[model samples]
Target: MEIVRPHSHRNLFSSNDAASAPTIPLYRSAPPLEVRLEDFESFAIDRLRVLKGISDGLSRGKKPDEMEKLVSELWKVNMRHQHASEVLNKDIISHFVLRLVYCRTEDLRKWFLSMECALFRYRFRFLTAEAQRAIMDEFDITCKAVNIMEFESIKEKLGQVARSMGQPLPTGDAIFYKVPFEDVPELVAGRRVLLSQGYAYVAMNQVVSLVATLFRSQLSKTLILTNRKWTSSIREQEKHRLTPIVEALCSSYLGPDFSQPKEYAEISLKDIDQLAKTSFPLCMRHQFDKLKEDHHLKHGGRMQLGLFLKGVGLNLDDALAFWRAEFSKKVGLEKFEKEYAYTIRHNYGKEGKRTDYTPYSCYKIISSTPGAGDHHGCPYRHFSEENLRAALSRMGVNSRAMEDVMNKVRNRHYQLACTLTFEALHGVPCDAGINHPNQYFNDSQKILQPKKDSST
Candidate 1:
């Protein structure tokens, strides 16, 4: 394997003449090149935007024509914004930078790998046949095209299987990939294609699904291995290089921006009840309701609601007081202090790990499973259809809006349901995807508050 080490102090792509230019590798490494912090952040954000757009497009279930247009639009935007000649280099570098930002924890790591694989699948699927062959060679993926003669011989069997799986078998004009039969469990389980002596004959249209699975698995393993090698020495050397760039990228769009306290400070514990009724996402709203009505919450509910309250500018003292007041109603003052005070302080970074825990993102909340008696997870995902509809109805979501949101939920687009919920409550289109709970809160505030008037 060729390691793509960038020259210490030069442009990755300088010459316009292809014959004279160096061959860029499939992946690029970060060089010890000095750059303005702004430029570094801009590059990473541009790539992040592309990744996010891909994720959003997938969630919407775009058709082939729409998907092609979307990818082309994203590509043009990225290329126009950056040096067009070094598009590949910029893409590779930004990916590595984001890996640093998102690799700090397990949830971030899963999300990064998932989105990156989807982006790769889109790009790979759109490549010309010759281009696909080159990439396959570069990546050492053993998958190969099944020629017309081979496909013709097996077309009948393939068609039979495809029909059984409720998928169409491609004609001779379409390409087929001969991959190991064991690799594509989705296709295999669906009986979507024929398996020969050892290979699964997958249609060109379905190839992306297989590639994405393999890509995500390989990339996930690589991240885990690389994380192990990221020792103190490596972090010390790359802290300046990696930390600021990732932080700026994340803070700008992907995650919470803790530096901006004024926005969150607009609301306090005093207004939480009213605000929960109006602004909180259904998951948090349910937790708040249960906390108030029952005067107790399971561990999961406490963690979910506690961090959200913290994100909404509830200070350590205020959080302690709020929980103490609520819990003391049932547990009494002494038991509340002994049993709950320390945990609340720990959430606020006053005890235990001392790590300032960020509130759960929409991805984290929806992906988590709530057990019996727990009301902490995304309602759209965890609730039964009847239960979810009832919950939404109680929250004043109109029937039409409830139907639309539930359709997305039935399709397992939980995040999109949350996005629709944002739209329903705020009465405006939220163009950006809803990925984090704090983001939902912030967006609600932005829409609810007048631009000229900060006095909420």
Candidate 2:
């Protein structure tokens, strides 16, 4: 591989934001690799194996004791891996922070370690290369000529810098609060609380493992690998806060790309009723069929129902207009009055519920579906063409040109689901952290520095 000189923030692993110019300049003289391009089922089959063994052990042995052993074993592996994988796979880390990773080679570890002294000032395109160099020099100088600041002190100093710059704070998986435990409801089950606590611990370990894997994906190899059980205690915090953002952004991007016509395709509900005979996503077709044959609903009935309400009175072109008007009114219509309102119009303007969807209009539908395990409503998985046709038939959905939509569903092209509905939920601001104690980044580093065996 050709060695490209590592430039600060520009070329190195810029965390999850490679989509943009790099901000941190790597200090290395060269890089090792180039990253350019970026499974769900039968997973249960493997878990079933473990479950059977554990069950047998419990039945043939001391039940609680066996359960304890089983739990401990599962805990160990989960703490080491899964939680972090969830975050990394979900792409939350890149959302909040600028990431940087130098192209790696196994042989360079010792050399990189020796030269990492001037690490802090490494600049990227965002900052001058000189700025990065300066930070690195200062870091090096501090390591050598001054006191070595622990990661905690460094984090605080960085936090101060971030505040001074008016940038977002660097976050970890876990969070801490001043709230005392005594304030919790006495009626709450002690075991449930304990379970939640256990899950919290497991979450932090996952975050660390996630960090490790993220390093692998971006930098091509794992860094600061987990031992057995770590990252879990903090991960649940991030998972709760980040999941919504991921859903919104990914869904937005993955959502149906709407076609803006010079004029809207205006059709009465009665017209749509005829078109409902055929459409994509079998579910909608079937539902429309059911409504027509069984309930004998008319275009008026279907149109009044709305797709979400099982109505097909209006075509997608008009439906898009309907949603745009709904949220535009809800958030208030002083477009010229306030700047943020405009931001809302520009972002969540067209997409349903995800107008606040930043970066990408991607969303994950969490609906009631089998095997969805809490997060469901992916049209690719849930939709059937016949049912969709039936539902649309009842709703008077008039669109013979819905073949494009069916193609998306038959191919499991899920993001296309949002496109057909031309209906996006409002980009709801997720303030879940207010009630969720776990969303706060953790302070564990103050007590325990991240290290090789830090997970244990």
Candidate 3:
């Protein structure tokens, strides 16, 4: 395994040469040279944010144009660069770092591969013809260009396929490639290209799909090999230093901290019931309902719901009063004060470590393991199919909406299912998708309580 040193401090490609260079990377090389601990973590986290943006857009069923717009905005924000070399080096180092982080599990590998493929396709589609050709040549992708004589014979069939895809027929001199159907299954499956015998006639505009297929195949194998190397050959000391970072990245929440309440109306104990009905996410609502019915919640439910309420503007006084009011019903005031008051105060940063813990994001909630009788984790992830269906029905999701949400759930896209549930209940698309419980609550409030214009 050859180690490739990252040229982050110097330019690998001159500015004049950037236009024709293949800026989109294949990541076929080994891991980059040693980076500082801080750089290593920050680079990986930033790249993960980009990948998550892509995943969220796709999961929410954004159309191709919408997804492209979303990804472009994300790239500009998270991956802005002053020079082409800087961009390529950061891209390379970040890809290798995330491979280490995501290679540990099958689910993680699938997610990374999917998002990376999407990223590759986005870059490939936007590149100049020369740049795309350079990448194809670099990868040794052999697709025979259809000659004029051969193209003339198939032009009508190809035009029909293009028209079906809502594209106009290419000019007489337009280029098409003849590749095995297996090389571009997505185009074949979508019927976006003409297929005759075993070969598929892919239009030049649709070549990104073929390149993306290759990237996915290569990256999938790399991730498995990375996992094997990670577990078996890496030095024990290196693993000791890096494993914690990998684990943290896997479960880390990169969103804004929701420890402090946003600028919303202050929530009192009396408003809790109404808010739970109209504004709370399903996880919090489930905990709220359980607490109301049972007069108490175990530790897991308390922490989950407690931090969420704190994030929603329930100050310390109201938090303590709210918990005590219900808990006292079961444990009596003496025991409640002794056992439960401290934890509530601690969550408010008034006792113990006074850490002021942030509310759990969807990532954290979904990653959590809830034991039997606990209603702390994400419902979309933790609920059985029958239970999820019943929960959606209770939320007044229509039959069609239920099917859409259930389909996302069946595909193991729990967050997407949650986003669909939000859309179905609210009657609007969750454009950014639901990343945090607080985000869902805030979005719901924006809809349910539209602010009045003071000037008016």
Candidate 4:
């Protein structure tokens, strides 16, 4: 498909003069005047890689330090390479490329919005005071700071609450935002602020969260418009240009070559029991053990465990034989053939639709809500606090480490909890965040592998 240059729009060249300025363009489709054809796609993909890096870090429950490092690296490598004017233009242009590729489906739109929000939030956090003011003016963000003289009256009440919460009182020089009372609900719920009339007084540090919310709201509305604008035209030609981008986006989060037999072809049925014992993530290992003990797993467990084994290099024949051997012990071969053989073959793309299925990503696993008697989904997410703690204990996680993992789980940081678990199990710091179950397994394998001698 030909990548036709988009016709220039008026907003692409908006002036700084307020009197004649146009509305800020949300997503810029028009290419920059100086960019080559190769640069256009390269710029979008580079930005996408950055976005993926941010999302992947967040998905893995990366700490504030890790996130800040990611933002720093991104600025150094990508953002700093462009001029000041090109920075904003590149952000808009790269966004439009992904929008065109991802706007066709609800799932894609959701993924697109999430990564864009993360990207916007990260960039916003690093903007200088003057630059932030400029962006706010451009976007018509009128988040007013409360005057110091006016804040003096509420200072006593603020100090009282701050002392009660064991937080230091903001000094006379602290900056406060006069936001809507509803916007900073956490402060309101915690009674950390003074609410006078309708407005909530919030500290300057909390303003970024409010700003991020506003950015997300605006971007969401813009994406709806973008989806409508692009859906009708994202046909054969557009698909040709975007197919690789979509695949790469998926690969960045989902495991690569999920449907192929490259990494796992040498893995035979005899090896699965030992491999699973040593290499599987906690979620998959739990399922593997349960299937062995009970001689049955619910559909959810089967699907998750089945696809995982496939990605780990279990071939179709070995997969069928593996399941058959386990189930035949409980139900006999004839019954196993009648009830389960087709589903196993189906998962292998041997039956209807013939669609080669991929293993579920970490996001998919954690997000799934299992039904009764189902032991399929993420342990951190699916298990209760007590149950999760007990499970972690059995896996040799110390009480202190387990407490930390539990805290992450309680705060809905399941991926981070998994990372902590990975660290504890492997006894090393894993530099990369876990995005896919296959990634978890692969990382475990690498960590467990013996170090080669440099002399060799």
Candidate 1 per-residue C-alpha lDDT over 85-175 given as tens digits, one digit per residue, 9 for 90 to 100: 5565565556666776676668778878878776777677777766666655655677768988998899888888778877766677878
Candidate 2 per-residue lDDT, tens place, 106-148, comes to 3333322322211211112124534433433522322121123
Consecutive 10-residue window with the lowest summed lDDT within model 2: 432-441
What TM-score does candidate 1 reach?
0.59
What TM-score, over all chains together, does every model reach?
0.59, 0.25, 0.89, 0.62
Q: Please provide, for model 4 over 110-229, each residue's C-alpha lDDT reduced to its tens digit, 9 standing for 90 to 100.
A: 877888777666666676765655655666667787788877988988788678878888898988878788776656786777788998877766665666666667767766776776
Evaluated at residue 170, the lDDT of candidate 4 is 80
Q: List the RMSD of every prediction in angstroms.
A: 8.3, 24.8, 3.4, 7.3
Model 4 clashes, total count: 1
Candidate 2 global TM-score: 0.25
lDDT values for all models: 0.73, 0.30, 0.84, 0.72
lDDT of 1 at 324: 88
Error at 310, model 1, angstroms: 1.4
lDDT of 1 at 341: 92
Model 1 CA deviation exceeding 4 Å by range = 1-49, 61-86, 92-253, 257-262, 451-456
